[model samples]
Target: MLILGAGQVRQALDGAESEVVEAVRQAYRLHERGLTELPHSVFLRFPDSARNRIIGLPAYLGDDTPVAGIKWISSFPGNVAAGLERASAALILNSMRTGQPEALLEASVISARRTAASAALAAATLAPAGPQTGVSLIGCGVINFEVLVFLSALLPELDTVTVFDLDRSRAESFAARCTARLPGLKVTVADRVEDALAAHRLIALATTASTPHLAVESCRPGTLLLHLSLRDLTPETILAGVNIVDDADHVCREATSLHLTEQQVGNRDFITASLGEILADDGYRRDETALTIFSPFGLGILDLAVADLVRRTADHLGLGTRIPDFLPG
Candidate 1:
């Protein structure tokens, strides 16, 4: 068995945004082609704290580079109060031939990057024209920060970013990090969520909001909203926008915004199309004037695909510790 810590995984995936994005894109295509096995994510919640939960995402990608794995990640919103990140994760890859555990790796970076890459791929496929003026990041967290990085890679023309957070200091910190990472890019901190939401045609929400809060009254055409945090938007807000999800069955569960919307309308008609289906169809484009929101439930196949990439890279670079006799021979 090979053991890769966070630093190793980070080293493996860092500065490889293009590769990671492409890996996520291929994973989506494979998933859409029904070449993957992804069971519904298992959520473990506590009765004492409704805000904290850990999820188990198991998946198998049977593509040219086949892989099977599960990502165990926890999200505790209160962690940020203690100056700690809200999410921490680990992934385990199992050998398909022998059913033996091949590697154990820290996966928080993998998770964040894959998610951002997925969001970016959605942006590329759905909003190919790219953002003209700038983009707004509603939640100034790790996910949004990574999204900004991937967006910058995909859309080099993007020159500005508007950020908003309930905590003004956090938003300021996020702005500093944004400008430092991508020099020459103008970053602004917004006073209100609505201010950030409507500040640009492209918007990304990656908050830890447990319930629905804000929604734009209207939006201009070609608006691309990356709804990374599943529960931030109200059902009414979702109904008003064109919905594109990573997967319907997985997304319409765990009380996500789409699930809530489904419950309210008693149907899944609010969704325009899956990101994969749209990517599969080259000539399918939606009305440019519609408020198109991509709500990715954070599919596990993406984790598997990215984990495979990290594992292979780290192995080639001699970045992980290996134990040959861990399993019965």
Candidate 2:
């Protein structure tokens, strides 16, 4: 068995944004081609605390090298107040040949990076016309920080970023980090969500909002909303936008914004196209005058893809801890 820590995973992926983006793109294409098996994510919630829960995403991706894995992740919104991370995760990978677990990896980094890469990939494809004037980040957290890192790599022409959060201090800190980490990019803190939403044409919603807080009227025309935090927007807001998703079936579950939209609209016709479809076929239509929303349900296959990449990198560099004869005969 191979055991990888967060630091090792980070080292393997350092300065590898382009490769990671391509990896996520390939994962999407494989999934679209029916080469992936993904079951609905399992959510385990607490009866007393609505703000904390855990999720399990199990999936299999078939290619020249097939792989199966499950990501066990926990999210506790109150962690921020306690000076801890909001999310933590681990990935367990099983060998296809023996059906035995071969590796265990720290997955929070993988989770955030893959998410950012997907958003970056979609940003490049959906808004290929020109560089975005700026981007509005709705949440000031680790996820948004990593998103900014990848966005800078993907869209360096972006010179400004507007940020907002319920906690003003967090927003300020996030702004400072962005400015320091990404030279030549200006980061500003917004006092209100509406102000942040109006500040840029490209917006990323990464908050832990359990219910809908945003309305369709708040967004501007020709906006690209990266709804990363699934359940933050109202059904009306979702119905009014030109929806794009990683997988329609995956996003339309677990009470996400798209799921609520489907429930309200009684059909999936509102969804414009899957990201894979847009990537595979250039003829996919995108209305520049409408609000384009990309809601990714955070596919398990993504975690697997990055995990495999990290494993190979670790092997080449002699990084992860190895345990020979991990399985008994």
Candidate 3:
């Protein structure tokens, strides 16, 4: 078995958001064509703690090059206060020839990059107004940081960013980092979430909120909301937009904003199209009139595709530790 640590993973994917976005785009196209098998993610939560849980996502992606894997990840929101990462993950890819474990990798970076790439792809493919100069980030976390990076990679017109976080200090730190990463980029730390929401035509919500507590009525028409957190927007807010999801069946569960809206309306009529359908059918050339919301379910296939790329890159770069006898010989 080959073992890749976080540093190795990062080294393999450095400055590769464009490639990662294309990988995510291809994964969505393949998924739309039914070239993947993705079962429901397994959530293991404790009875005492509602904010923390571990998830197991098993997926098989088939094309000319086929691969299978499972990502084991844990989300503990309380870790941030202690100066620790909120999420940690690992992925194990199985050999297609012998069905044996071939590689093990630290997957939090893969997860974040793939997720951001997916969001970037959606933003590029769905935004009818094209890339905006200014954007708003609702949460100042690692996920949003990566999202901003990928968005900038895909849409270079984005030069201004407004950010809001309950922890003002963290928002300030996030701003500094953003400016440092993309020189000449202007970043604002907003004191109120509403101000951040109204700051730009492009908005990304990436928080750990377990419930819906947001209203989007104040935003302008044709606003692009990348609801990455999945639970920040209210059902009514969701209904106000032309909702596009990665997969209706996968997203319309887990009590997400879409799920809550479905329960409230007793149907999925608000959903306009899957990101896959939009990608496969080329989702552009439409008049910009109504609100647009892209709510991805964070599909397992995305993780698999990105992780496989990392694995291949690491292999080519001579990274990772090879355990010749990790399995029974």
State TM-scores per candidate: 0.97, 0.97, 0.98
lDDT of 2 at 217: 68
RMSD after CA superposition, every candidate: 1.3, 1.2, 1.1
Clash-forming residue pairs, model 3: none
Question: lDDT-based ranking, best first?
Answer: 2, 3, 1
lDDT string, candidate 2, 67-105, tens digits: 999999999999989999999999999989989999999
Score each candidate by Cα lDDT. Answer: 0.90, 0.91, 0.90
Tens digits of per-residue lDDT for model 3, 222-311: 888999989988898888788899999899998899999999999999998998898877635433777789999899999999998998
Write the residue-wise lDDT of candidate 1 on 125-242 in tens digits. Answer: 8764544558899888899999999999988888989999999999999999999999879999988777777788888889898888776764456688898999988999899888
Clashes of each: 2, 0, 0
Q: Give candidate 2 misplaced runs (Cα > 4 Å).
A: none
Q: Which candidate gets the maximum TM-score versus the true structure? A: 3
Model 3's TM-score against the true structure: 0.98
